[model samples]
Target: MAQPYADTIACIRKSTAEMRDLQRGAMDLDAPGTEARLEQTVRELQARVDEQQAALEQLRSSSHVDIQQVAYASGNPRDKLKQLRAVTAAYTGLTTVAPFLPSKDSMLPALLAARALQQNIRGTKQAIASAEAQITANGALLKQEESNLHDANLIEKALRDRTVRLEAQIEDRSQKAPAQLAKELIAAKRAEKKRHDEETQRLGDALNDFVDNYLSAMLAAEELGGPVVGDMLNVENETLAAGFTKKGKAKATKKLVSGKTRQRRIDQIWGSKIAVEEEEEAPLTEAEAADAEMRELIGILFKTLTGPGGGRAYHQLERDSAASRFLIRAKIAQFHPKDAQKLRLIDFGRELDD
Candidate 1:
């Protein structure tokens, strides 16, 4: 059961695989590879098509046996045998033949030879019938496979065309990436130098300008602290409001970093002495220096308070810990005792009540 063009389609699949691999950026599909791969695929496909065509030609040649051979092999079984006997008798000259008559001794051998020839013909016909039946059973599947191959070929062609276009894109990106980066750098430098004039007749507008640049710089350098937004306020919208803190001073965060990014930013500004024998080459920004000092202070406090032979988890030192009486005074309370007790959960809180 041979499908037409099966091998040709298989070759196309190989080309498709090559195209897919090229897409994965394995080979750039540059000038030499493109032409060579395309030629190789074409050669293979042509070879397969040619080979299948030859096989089909052979099948056709064998199928077209002489009609006369099949014709005599047809008709009723007994009648055909009688006819065959008649023909065989004439062959041995047992019946009237021009100037010839066969003897009984010659007739027997001649008849045996004729019978053998008839049996051979019958076997050949039966073999041809079996072959036809097998062909009929498998022929549909072969044709179906060929049809699917055609669809796959079409998809493969699309993939090839798309690949050609994509190769151009890869080339374009390779050419433009550096130039584009330079362009972005120039734009960034220009933006850095461009400053908005903070001087305005309105004091509110002037202060807002400082807030804008301060936030911008804080974002650029995370060590630079900002106004404590959303603390003791109705919502984030009340960040600009006053009287939140008694001294109106915004509270700073505990210097705990939230993610690797902020930690890296801190490290970049304040180089790590922990990782090197000598100090890092770069000088620290003032904010960075302050943060480093605070970090050192916290480290010392932690080691003294809670490391081995320590008396505290430092739990009692906290403002609301149950062991508040263990400390002489609490320096970390959010408010004066009278007002602070008002914000307690219930029963004036166990810490304050105790």
Candidate 2:
């Protein structure tokens, strides 16, 4: 299962890791070198414009003198001389300032280039703006993830504390009467184990069903041109199918054995089955159930001390509230440790007093 909060946290972390890289890219777009290059280009264009203006001014200042020289040197009729002078002066002006003229060919192209540069600068600014927005969004997501983690931590802590307290109570209770309590605790432990095994089996069954459905969906998707392809598709489908089939079978077997009839059969075959069978005949009140659970926990602890591979099992049980309590009681009863304190009886005579 994908936890959204956890995934969000992961994404946030990934974003944070890439922040420096993205920032670097953004910085490069407007770096000192880039800015310097742009400035240099603009300066060169300005210098060209200044030179053109100077040449145009110089041409305008000499146009009259050139016309007069042309008229005086031509030795022709007055009308012809005037026409020649006028034509020569016009030609001189055009030739002198032609290179400096801001032409339709030159000015238009320069204007377009300048506009393109401006657009690039605008795009860079927009990119920076987008990055900043992403950063803000990522920051908020990270904070939410942290809050979720904190809440989960608190819940885990509460569970742990309750488990520990229950264990201590069971320990104290078992010490009050060793032999009798031990037997009762053993029976309780067996019942508790049966429940735990059944619950675990149920969970396994559900998980198997989920896996099978998921695989079937994936296979269907692959057939429909989804992501699955080639060897990857074949391998994944085979692996998933095999695992789901095996788990489904195992869960079914466990569920079959979880019934009351199976319990009776086991009891008939095993004469040494503890006397706690009476509690299974009827649904217990909340108080009775709790006590029964605690006794079962103690029984588990006793088994841990005497049975093979029981130490680790006992330790694991201690981590669970109901299981831990039962183990503690069983341990206190079986060992009859002197330092173990008796549990204070509540008004219901079931729960340990505060």
Clashing pairs in 2: 188-296, 189-296, 297-326, 297-327, 298-326, 298-327, 298-330
Report the lDDT tens digits of candidate 2 across residue range 198-308: 997897577446434433333322222333422233323223222223222212223322345433432332222223466566532222333344444444544554567
lDDT of 1 by residue, 1-354 (tens): 244444544565566556456544533536575556656655665776798799878866888755456447547898678768867785888445454233332333434555675576566556656655766667887888899999999999999999999998779767787879689779977776653222223654554454343322322222223333222222221122111245545444434334454445445444454232246754443333433433333344435444563322222222232112111123322223543321111112334333
Off by over 4 Å in 1: 1-106, 177-354
Q: Which candidate number has the best lDDT?
A: 2
Q: What are the per-model numbers of colliding residue pairs?
A: 0, 7
Which ranges in model 2 have alpha carbons more than 4 Å from their true place?
Answer: 1-124, 136-144, 147-151, 190-354
What Cα-based lDDT does every candidate model obtain? Answer: 0.46, 0.49
